[model samples]
Target chain A: MELKNLGEFNFIHSIESDTIYDPNTVVQGIGDDCAVYKVTEGYEQLVSTDTMVEGVHFSFQYMMPYDVGYRLMTANLSDIAAMGGIPRQVVLSVAAPGHIDTRILEEIYRGVKEQCQHYHVNLIGGDTVSIDGPMVWTITIIGEIPQGKAVLRSGAQPGDVVGVTNYIGYAATGLGSLSYNLDGYPMTRIGHQRPEPQIELGITLRELGVHSMNDISDGLSSELNEIAKSSRVSIIIDETLIPLHEETYKLAEALQTNPIDYALLGGEDFQLVFTAPKELSKALENLGSITLIGEVIEGEPVVQSVTKAKEIRLLEAKGYNHFHE
Target chain B: MELKNLGEFNFIHSIESDTIYDPNTVVQGIGDDCAVYKVTEGYEQLVSTDTMVEGVHFSFQYMMPYDVGYRLMTANLSDIAAMGGIPRQVVLSVAAPGHIDTRILEEIYRGVKEQCQHYHVNLIGGDTVSIDGPMVWTITIIGEIPQGKAVLRSGAQPGDVVGVTNYIGYAATGLGSLSYNLDGYPMTRIGHQRPEPQIELGITLRELGVHSMNDISDGLSSELNEIAKSSRVSIIIDETLIPLHEETYKLAEALQTNPIDYALLGGEDFQLVFTAPKELSKALENLGSITLIGEVIEGEPVVQSVTKAKEIRLLEAKGYNHFHE
Candidate 1:
């Protein structure tokens, strides 16, 4: 199935169902801040890793080592959030050129440690090797998802309402700011350099029984498609109902591109996209900041838009592909 | 401080110890073939990650993708073994160009899966992306170690005999064969291609009063230096007692390089270098095809000649350096 409309969580949830063995050991697998496994009876373990490279995944003009460190750490923490896990330790294996400053290396580690300490995750073991070209860093994170519980990405079914933790397309807007010259968008620079992972919301959602879930790294549509494929169900998203920040809308309007397209296809959002049964949906209504976007359906894999004139099919995959140009 | 001299297990152990928090649930940390944690009372989880790159770390000319897969998988398995853990699942991340063959990729994964099944590990999740040049593959291994009994590299004390599970310097010899035209050294080629990780020996050592230990990756001298640094003890080696394979010595003789130096300085020998008390050392006298290279001391690190009339001190800290051209 295509990755676009299904979204990151859905893709992960589908994969998680088939991958999780020794379920009793995996307190939670895929679809949360991180994958939570019980390391022992009383304590929990968190694991997440991210790969960042030049040209394909990122560009040199837009990224620095410290920024790389910050983003990589955030990616890992996002995994921890998806699992309702709290991070405690991390190991970084970074490959770069020999001439990169020892301080720059220190800065990368410092950024990583800063995030870890912020999340209460400690900086531990790592390997630093010099390479000739673009730099590549992979950080493996270990955290605790809490005892006796973990949030999975495969629990959503029909009659469940779809909800998102924050306004989508901000990171994408930030990307637009990087790729093209866009002005007047606040936090666009910060969003590109220092995207945040929603850890608290992930735990609350798990405790509140927010069914199937995932983080929005591969754009909103891609994540939804993943959940749909994994749960073997369909999702219907309201095109107009998707919440977009004024910055994102303004940027899209300036670029002459549809804001809905950016919301649907822009990646690196790192927000939570979850589904919950109708009965449990009310718990999230007034609980905090959230936006109700759509609902689950029982049919073929497709995200249909609900509108007055006609229901539009928006299920075609529309984000990044490693192999495709 | 450099990776080449740090050795794998010692580096990982340092990271594991410093990184983990509320590690009550961690059945096993670093020092094993994988990191094992209890997800629940009834089940356990394992996780590990290995990164391989071109030119600096490996050469495509001498190593096939299948062999790369084998070596990478073995590296991950070594982590699991160090923890006294069993492998359950693995996630592989690869960065390569689109033109790479599907069959080669399948064969690589086939080798990985074969080894996993052989060791009772599973192939679970991973990321794949295209890069500008050279293929870099990173695999994260998940495993299970028993509760309360994982080994540590920092557990060694003085008065312990330094033991090596098998012959050292083969992998480095093999690497030398590829680049230096070592026609006489048939074994060096094998060493470069398929170095074994002493998985069984690692698990067995955990029950043998073994103290500080690490894999002999960056030469015997380099690994010994790490054990000395970490356990805060000196290790004195009897130079004459060191083991040297016939082919390695033959090649070294042809090249005017001392076979002893090659054996001592060569890296990528994935055998276990560990310490045990005198009684346990004697018990290991005829255990298997192994080597009792030296003993842990109280004062300073030294490798002295036992046969020559005048004692010759071995060169200090002159092993492989990844950063050195």
Candidate 2:
């Protein structure tokens, strides 16, 4: 059904009914000018917003509406996770052209609902607008962490171990598979479509006294550079320590590109990169699939990659800049 | 300079410098993956998000980029004000076409900074994306109010007086003036371009035991209908009591339309409409520029307007629907 035929109020009502109930924190959700929530004592609040514009962030030809919504929520959830906070509430703002069918929004909301249920976050309040421009989805997530427990990007210190939560380069390889329509690599396609946020891993790292952390939304190199710049430290990573899925290397070979390039420069991996003191290496390894990739040193805020042969190469501070791209 | 030349990181740096500092609640602002704030104890949090699309919400031919930013912030602030909450922090998500000039965004941020400083709200973290579509601005405001002090739309009681904070219909007249190039309505034009949210007034009303409140963004009739429905009460307004600017009448007469229509149906006024007990009538009257225009009665949710000639007319709940428009 067309949105005009469904009417804005009724459409909002549909969303209200679809929203998951959260009686504990939510004082009031939809049907009000603002969503009200009771903040627990001794907790600090975390907020992050992300926008996805059709044709810029994703193409309808390549992404289902459900995938689009799921990816948008994942991006916001990842930001909260990067801070070692538990995401609790979200508000979304959506703008779409009138020519689109309303069922697409339902599918999108379904994806959103699935994510919210899985993450135990409430869809509190949001606004919807009809525009002549392409569809744009923006979500603001509200999360919480115990006072003084939230981590920042400026805490890394010299001799701290730089580690990542999981294998990198899979998301880029997934995009490549879809772009080339490769027959195999279903996992890579799923990786690109539904990147997971390491929420539990982030909390565990924070509890384990990790110094600084960031989510790899703009490639591993850019995230590491951010941590280094914020903490005013230099980081040196060994190329041989970096973990890559075997399929990623196979896809890189098929595309005649270096798999290392995808691991370092490709974006939207959503893996966690963090720094912790050397003593915590055993504890960090015991948690899960974390790999120690580098160490922090007192120097200019830069990232350098050491080759397997012990040759040092300075990595350019370049990644996906939305404007420059 | 074009945004392409400025680049995303530098653009974000520009915004970071423009941000107003708040040392108490803001733990971190721009540049982090997520902004962090320390919520004071015994306060409930209020969150509201609003989106403005370039062609749909404002046209560049009519609105300067600075005004666009200012107005977008105003809309979100008004939502918080409706709940009698003190807005503290905001996160913005912006998507713009790559061809746009970078200076336009600078101007937009300048206006945002101006509002933040004026309101004492901090600009926190946000995301910027390049789109192939029209510019879209979405802002999420975080606010706080003492527990149990938030004025909701469902709290109006029978015999409560319905009051408005300021004069109405000026914004509609402003749009009329801009559309027709009508002179002698500069104030109305300014009203449309830069609305002032009634944040202080809302707090005062809440202190005075005002039962319910809402911002008049969707015309007096629609706002009254919302309160009536939410509070499960009928409201009767005397048409002659509505405070409208003299110039609004002049413009309405010149355009061969009833001035009352604008007062009843115009959108984007950003004035506060509230319900308070009758015993507080004198205190309400003392508040500057307030006008009591109606009374709540125990009945079905409906809004009826009483003419000077003693004729009663049912007011339809009609307002701007983006999809229908």
Candidate 3:
């Protein structure tokens, strides 16, 4: 079951799919020298890339090669999702350490291919090189957004209702749990291994005419702060109203860190946070149970305390930055 | 300057250019997360990727970060060039060491952007991550070839003339100079550090209608051997006509290796080695000074010698395979 036993070609073969292809749209997919997608009407091309480095992004002992593939693929897919676009194809360039089994390499590709199949995206061409150190997997995904329908980080308006898709801080808690060698918290562990991307929900929100959007890869508070800075608006968050998974709270309590802080500044959640006009609130109501954390304000950045006791302004944004570490 | 010194935004900013956008076709190029190229009529899309790892593909002491960027970008561009296509855009992903200097990172991007401007490629979008070890830079380039005009490795026919652009083994020689700490050979060093992709020459050959083509990165003899195996034809290479750089011979003589062997088996030259039918030989006559090394034969894979010289069937491929070392 480990990647080391699954040969590369076999891994690729296992993930190949026979999806319905529109000849005019995609000239080639999985099997060719390159996956060719046609640039057609009503669509503007969107692309995003992510490279996951060993020891930095994930640990070899704790994470499976398949999990690494899944995580890396999801990272790119989330960018497309943030743009309210359907991912079409992915090109991968992987650099592996010498002496790593070819089977593990195959498993990594298998993981990548499986994710592409799940999202109905094609696995196109890529390059594989051997490295002198740890493995590095880089994926470039090409997507298509409907003309004039892109959801930008700078489009949030003041007075719009701030919304978040699901509980916050779980992924960070998951990462914390694994890194600290804490016992229990399987949910958090799963969250760390696979952060669910809010692709479908993002599309729905876009259709409902949401004001602006961004994925919460870094913690919710950090991402919200980004929106506020980019849109030049202030955002308030009802600390008590922010959702936290049951396991996340328990783990945070055990670690002596505020569960709210975890939810506020935790990273790699891949959840969508957006603001919508008052009129679109009704549409959102029918779509899902959206917890309104707060509303965008015309002034400076602030994340209000839900207890009404501590009205703290979360001015500093915290999340993941490659160099900041 | 090291990459750590160049802040991320500044790095991206330093590489921006106007050549990335062409009114003839592309809707967008570089900037805005991804480079978008409008698929023009009568053109087929081609894409290629290559990842170069530090300590594997390069060493910081021998080559500057800019040359790393230049070489990495050229590797993929050369693939596009080999396909006889115009490279329009590239996605670059880098996994930097956590403590890298920002200035050096900026130089890398600046080098990449310079190459993009020189080759007329747009820097679409890419991801950056911090790692625990040496830096890894990966580039994926998208190109366009005229429909039905792409020459494949398997298209060599019997009686076709084998031709190569420029001399071979210079890069290998240059690599020796750097690795062995030899005195200066700027041409050799430049040849090794920055490969001149035969983009224009490939386009010309494509227009002239060639049978088969490939970029010679995996050495002259190895690539020719691949063509023979894939095309199911034999080739007779004249040792006397094999073009070896003067520096290569000097380095080989010093190292006690055959210069002809270096030219035949060394890799990373990035020149185009191709085949054309006998009828098109006249048209290709004026295409620089190309040496007619051999002719395709009907029999099995074999490299015959001219003038009753000793024939070397085919040496094992001794090019750069990261895992082999």
lDDT of each: 0.65, 0.88, 0.74
Encode model 2's per-residue lDDT on A1-325: one tens digit a residue. Answer: 9887787787888888756545689888888889899877888899999998888888767678898888888988999999988989999988988878999998888878778888989999999998787889999999998888888999999999999988888899899888898978888788888888889998888889999999988888888999999999999999788889888989988989878888899888888999999999999888768999999999999999998789999887677888885
lDDT of 3 at B33: 31
Cα lDDT tens digits for candidate 3, A116-213: 77877766667666666778888887877776677777788988998888878888888888888988889878887877677788788888888888
Rank order by lDDT, top first?
2, 3, 1
Candidate 3 at B282: error in angstroms? 1.4
* DockQ winner between candidates 1 and 2: 2
Rank ordering of all candidates by DockQ, starting from the highest: 2, 3, 1
Candidate 1 lDDT over B248-284, as tens digits, reads: 6776767777777665788777777778887886667
| Model 1 chain A worst lDDT window (10 residues) | A27-36
Better candidate by lDDT, 1 or 3: 3
Question: What is model 3's DockQ versus the real complex?
Answer: 0.39
Residue B211: error of model 2 in Å?
A: 1.1
- The segments of candidate 3 whose C-alpha lies over 4 angstroms from its true place after superposition are A1-37, A60-62, A176-188, A252-256, A299-312, B1-38, B177-185, B246-257, B299-312
Query: What would the per-residue lDDT of candidate 1 be over residues A1-325, giving only the tens digit for each residue?
Result: 2222343223323323333323443543432111334454465555555677766666647767677677778888887787666665555566666655455555566566567657765443344555666667777766675554555555669999999987788888877877786667658667777788888888888888887778888888888887776677889988888888888878877889888877788888788888988887678887667788899989986667764346677666564665653
Ranking by TM-score: 2, 3, 1
Least accurate 10 contiguous residues by lDDT in model 1 chain B: B27-36
